[model samples]
Target: MLSIIYYFVFNIFIGDYIKYSCIVPADASFQVYRDNFIFFVKVFYYFRYFLFCFIIVIRLFYVKNKFFRWLIKKICYFA
Candidate 1:
């Protein structure tokens, strides 16, 4: 829902650049940019998910033992 609104607002602001230029407003270029933007967004979404999962996993490990704390410390040291 938010993305749809963003797309509309974004196009409203930027559409003229593409529409008025010598470049053809063909479906191929539109789809290419659309797919690239979607892929970039998805990558960030997955990264956030991965970070959330990592935090949860670390929390669980911390709950398990002092050894896990040491392990995390070591990992952080190298990280």
Candidate 2:
């Protein structure tokens, strides 16, 4: 169940990345960039961007929730 959730999160992030990356670049270079790689390579290249997004989500969640902060503190204190 947790893995499924993570997969959905990653899928959403990757979809957004491809959507914005393709639309945001106006130059021929972007086409060249896309053409230079095969499909799997492109997905592999975007994995780091996904990790970056995951970190940002975690950071934002951590900042927004007092419960999460307290939970982390207790875990650390107990550990």
Candidate 3:
């Protein structure tokens, strides 16, 4: 779907799209940077994979078109 493709593309170029600002507090410790990196990795992992798949499955299940749902189910079974 276009949503999946767009999200994947966004993830691919996110590193370039987002720039690191060099502002820091004087009292901030090194652990803050490590924590931020961990959070970033978690977001990248969950958003690109789990989050969208969950949304799509929920949307498909809620659709009123039985034929379309059946088609997707068949395709997913083989995929």
Q: What's model 3's lDDT at 21?
A: 20
Q: What lDDT score belongs to each candidate, Candidate 1 first?
A: 0.60, 0.64, 0.65
**Stretches of model 1 off by over 4 angstroms after superposition:** 1-26, 57-64
Candidate 3, residue 56: Cα displacement in angstroms equals 2.1
Q: How does candidate 2 fare on TM-score? A: 0.31
- Model 2 scores worst on lDDT over the 10 consecutive residues at 36-45
Model 3, 1-79: lDDT tens digits are 8787766565655544333322333345856875676577557655666766877887987799998799889988998
Model 1 RMSD in Å is 9.8
Candidate 1, residues 1-79, lDDT tens digits: the string is: 8557645544453454434433534487587776665565556544545665676776867575888778778888898
**Model 3, global lDDT:** 0.65
Estimated TM-score per prediction? 0.47, 0.31, 0.39
Off by over 4 Å in 2: 36-79
